[model samples]
Target chain A: MKYCSHCSNEVTLRIPEGDTLPRYVCLHCQLIHYQNPKMVVGCIPEWEDRILLCRRAIEPHRGKWTLPAGFMENNETLPQGAARETLEEANARVEILDLYAAYSLPHISQVYLLFRAKLLDLDFSPGIESLEVKLFEERDIPWNEIAFQVIRTSLERFLLERRTGAPVFHTGKIDRSPI
Target chain B: MKYCSHCSNEVTLRIPEGDTLPRYVCLHCQLIHYQNPKMVVGCIPEWEDRILLCRRAIEPHRGKWTLPAGFMENNETLPQGAARETLEEANARVEILDLYAAYSLPHISQVYLLFRAKLLDLDFSPGIESLEVKLFEERDIPWNEIAFQVIRTSLERFLLERRTGAPVFHTGKIDRSPI
Candidate 1:
């Protein structure tokens, strides 16, 4: 954040009055730009006994297989964002269930809210951002090829707890980990 | 936003190539500025049969009672953010429990993550953001004077669920409503 997005003026990083943290303050407009933690919402799309995963075509974890998820967009609920990301990445439709897990990556300032979803059909293909999309059974999951720590934990916990069919909420902190 | 925060140049709102949403793109640097929903974290601080509440000293709901919560900051977990907000608002200490409820207020592009916390001590007072901070029993809760709908719902759920001592996660969407 070098300049003010509102006035195109140079911004200074300083703590405003009555505030404890430093923020980007515009020199001319005096607008304070605060950066907060972002929510990355997605879901574990399940079809029968298999869980859907997408092979990333983008960097950060290219070629790695993971759940269909992305950053939550504006003007949408968490489940809606999770479903949208699933559609965008794998062209899959899912009935979003309970929010299954929330992993806060403090190092990256991101909170991933993943849900347990039921895949509506088998007619799904990869979107532009994915090289491939496939359903993997529990024993067939590519644990070693998973994208991030948060997603890996979500998958492991989901498979372990699915037998009970109880909607249990999971939460954790993944600081200094791959996410 | 009219200017690029990175280059101090004029920006235009347009859909970037390979993207569906229109974002603020820099004319000079071509940096796409994407916006997402934010998380507002807080907790239902409990002590015995009473719950903690803070009266606003600021606008939006001036003088009305509310649970301590604010926009989640960077470099912290969801539970940590909830604890920080409780300490900041009421000058109180709390042990953050499981994430109790998640309410998505899409009207403002914000998600409220409220936890069930245990108040550690009674040595508390109002902080800069609050006019008064006090503990209230279930029957004495100010329903009409509650600050936000989310807080009200969280408090109601907390009291109702504490009886069984069961931890049940709650989720909802508060679109086109006061938050």
Candidate 2:
């Protein structure tokens, strides 16, 4: 950060006393600006035998299919955030079963928490952030047109463990090449 | 966030086009600063029949005992962040078994991800942020002296599920009254 968000003073990179990492400390107020990884909570919303997916209407992967998700907002639990994202992106409601996948993307400083959920109904359409919303069976999934790598992996894991109907816990790192 | 960190321009809160929530939008650079919940990763470091606990040397809960945890940083996985926090808070090394508990503290905009782990050795002391580091058996735990609500709940669940020796997945929310 060039300027302190707190005092509008200039900031400098320095390790505070009794701390290991250097942070952006305000020149006047000494307010430390700590940047932590954010949680991107969403769900694998299932309807009958099909899973819900949204086509992006915005940049960074426009028109690519993805599980409806977004950044977790303040004053909401992970599952609550997941449900909110689903409603926002796809105009869908879901009953969250369990947290299914947590992929740590150090390259982007994001932790994606995907829940295993059942869609309340098939009454879903594209929200503002989505070009369209649709349900896809495993064999009918547009694998080549998937959005994020983590989403693709989540879909794969979900399909793999579908037989047992057991919630799968997954943790992995995504090494995305810098654009 | 009064000023845009990118351009040092004054910012205004507004809901962007097609967005539900308002964000800190810069007037000059049009940079939208969106805040999200952060992950606090740590472990319940177990050494045989006891678990490690640290007394905080910092504010928010100074002098109270808690499981070693801190905000997850950039360039780290969930497990790695948990391990790092354990090492930093208690100067203890641990072998992480499985992600045991995840508690969402919406009142604080934080998610606590606690892992079930085995302490590598007893050669551990308090780190800079901790005044004291010690091991306590289930019965010897200072239940009243526990730091945060999540920490107390984590300890209780750990004790309750110790008999099965199987990792438990828990997700819950905490509501704090405004001071």
Docking quality (DockQ) for each candidate:
0.90, 0.76
Give per-residue CA lDDT, model 1, range A1-179, as digits (tens).
99998888899999999899999998799899999999999999988889999999998899999899899999999999999999999999999998899999999999999999999999999999999999998999988899898888878888888876865787998876664
Give the lDDT of residue B39 in candidate 1.
95
**Best by the lDDT measure:** 1
Best by DockQ: 1
| TM-score list, all predictions | 0.97, 0.96
Worst 10 residues of 2 chain B by lDDT: B170-179
User: Over the stretch B1-179, how does candidate 2's per-residue lDDT look in tens digits?
Assistant: 88787777788999988778899998788888888888999999998989899999998879889999999998788989999999999989999878888889888888999889999999999998999999998889988888888888777877888876865777877675321
The count of residue-pair clashes in candidate 1 stands at 0
- For every model in order, what is the number of clashing pairs? 0, 0
Kindly report the root-mean-square deviation of model 1 from the true structure over all alpha carbons: 1.5
| TM-score of model 2 (CA atoms) | 0.96
In model 2 chain A, which range of ten residues has the least summed lDDT? A170-179
